[model samples]
Target: MNEDRLQFWSLYATRFAEGFGFITLVTLLPSYINTLDPTGTTILGMTISAGLIVGFYTSGFTLAQTVAIVPLAWAGDRFDKRTVLLAVLAIGIGVYALFPLVDSSASLIAVRALQGVAVTGAGLMTLSLVGEIAAGSTRANHIGKANAASYAASIIGSISAGSLFELFGFGPIFAVIVCLMFVAWLGVFRYLKPDETRIHGFPFSDLALNRRLLTLSSFRFQYAFSVTLVRTWIPIFAGVAAAEGGLAYGGLAVALTVVAEKFTNMCCQPFTGRLSDSYGRAMFVFAGGAAYGFVALLVPFAPTIGAALALPTEIVLVVPSALAGIVLPAWIPLEVIPTQVSMFGEVSPAFLPLVALSGLLGIADSFREPASMALFADEGTDDGGVASSFGIRELVWRPGSVIAPLLGGWLMYEVSMASVFYVGGLFALTGVGTFLVILVWSHGRRALVEW
Candidate 1:
């Protein structure tokens, strides 16, 4: 391969391996927690293992890591991003390998939480590195490409989790992941070098969380609602409902829902994003929200598994839905900073910290996407009401991302998975309503625009 291709692949492979190792376990972590006590959740806590052990434990990762994202990114700007990258990868390796050390549900949860903590370095560094490495004209494409690797990683990990669980069990599987993390760690340590300059001490307080930035972050709330709800609840919802719905391979059916969502997200991203840019964010957001609502509604009523698989066609579109919902709305306030580097550069030193603290909003809420989205829109809020099409993305969705599965687990406990679908559908519709409100808010009168 040529030099550029080699570099891209190197980064992509590292990301993919980390993602594959992490997502596979995360999606399966709740199930693993439950497996420790098949009899019921009493052995673990007041609620299911997912809620008490997994959910609570996992947020430590999200909170610390997400809060660190902008700072980490700022660090990358000033220091050699590669140094930050190597250091974080090393930490991630240590954390992931320890998973096999725990025996009980409690210990397992703790280990998972610590794993989240270790991963933030890897997570933020990786994203910032992508920003540093790719040129402006090609940056979005690179980010999108890297994002696609996340989808592939989730598939590889989740599918492997199923196969590995049936064969060597969770212990062996985690061990394997640890080993893989080490390899990625080595690759990063040896081959990676920081080509980017370090950012000077950037303000973390007022600038990062300024009115313009905060306003931009608020738009993410609706997008987050759509992303988190479906990813977390859809599978359990479908998996549980499938048995009653007379489906074959209930497990497969459940997996299919998730896989379909991701696949739709990846495949539809280019088309949907371009369409959104062409048509405007509002139109796509409305359509995407409506689509999610429609799919979510279908899960409860799935008459058969074969028919059930169809929901991902629209309902489960992960990327498209996010692009539709987030891209236009979230970009509004990003323009306040003008340039990507300046965006962080202009933020007060405390601004980054507060922005990071703002992430706690999502972390505390089971790491739901809405919190992050809301924060993004809010942070991006500005004076000119200018709009731009770029921002940092937090994509270390591993066992560290406990909130979704934990919520999924509780959702499984309280009501039928189908009910969760209904709720998810309701959220989608609500998002659509939010989009409409934005348009009305922007304009004095109500008028509809077509994509």
Candidate 2:
């Protein structure tokens, strides 16, 4: 195979391994916590608290994604992506190894914050490398494949996580992930050779999350915000639909949603990724945004579960993949800007989305993600509060999302499946507006910055 082809596989392997952090939880986390904490225990509440606290803690993780990306990408640009990436894998594996062994809520939260930091490699370095190594023509297709690997990982992660939980317990489940991270690190180190590149210094200092990255990073927050909001309701919506439709899938709606999206995102992202490379990043961003808008419309109006699964195809494929694939490929190049100095590095890693969804994630970490991201934003970044600001928003979603489960199991559970679809669509539509405003406001400055 050609060098590019070889690197593609290497990138895929690393990404596939990295995906375990989030996807496995789709099927494993809730019950896993229940196992450790049991019912009505503080430990279980800690998981919810962890989700909430992690929103804040996740900001720390964003440092790994951006602050590190700035310096590392600079290295790759100046020297070799191989060395930079290998170092990342080592640090990542070491950090991820700590994830499974935490014995208390505080420890687990610390580990999760650390895991959030470690999770940055696949997203920041590996994905950015695809753009660096591939000719522009083929970059998006490669990204799509990367997304596919993630989807595949999500599907497999869920399956494996659930089985590991059943067979071995959380400790072993974490061990499996640790082993996967090790193997992934080794794959990149041994087989993935980086062809030498000669660029001027990746300008670690220049890429500082200064005005430019910060300003543009502000724009990026819109997409993240919208995504967090709409996604928060997905699990609730899906479960409600399953129950209302009288499908056996009711209980596992989140898992099934995760499986569906993982597969579809894997299948479709490459095409979209490629399209963004050729047509311009805005094309895909707007297209995805439009599709998101369309999908939002579907949740509100979907007549049947099958119809919900069909065209305008956003949620039909949205599962656990990259926060609803809300990404507008044009913006991803920011991953390379010296994360610490660049706006993307300094401000964006966690706060970009957290500012929007910290609360949303805390709440939706249970069911949705996009809804969490979309909760709030001002013309500037700090203008908004975490999802906690929209404290009552859950009250709106609870009726359809949280309550339906309680009620469905209790009285008047027989509500139409379409109602959940409609409710989710409303949250999604709110996201659509957030996306459009961001798209319109940040019109000129879509160019990529290098560290």
Which 10 consecutive positions of candidate 2 have the poorest summed lDDT? 371-380
The models' CA-based lDDT, in order, is: 0.48, 0.45
Q: How would you encode candidate 2's per-residue C-alpha lDDT over 166-187 as one tens digit per residue? A: 5666677667777887888887
Error (Å) of candidate 1 at residue 235 is 3.5
**Could you give candidate 1's per-residue lDDT for residues 64-117 as a string of tens digits?**
555555556555555665676677666666776676666676676566656655
Looking at candidate 1, the ten consecutive residues that score lowest on lDDT are: 382-391
- lDDT at residue 74 of model 1 (Cα atoms): 58
Candidate 2 lDDT (Cα, 0 to 1): 0.45
| TM-score of model 1 vs. true structure | 0.66
Q: lDDT at 428 for candidate 1?
A: 57
Residue 349 C-alpha lDDT in model 1:
22
Positional deviation of residue 448's Cα in model 2 after best superposition, in angstroms = 17
Angstrom error at residue 156, model 1: 1.8
- Which candidate number maximizes TM-score? 1
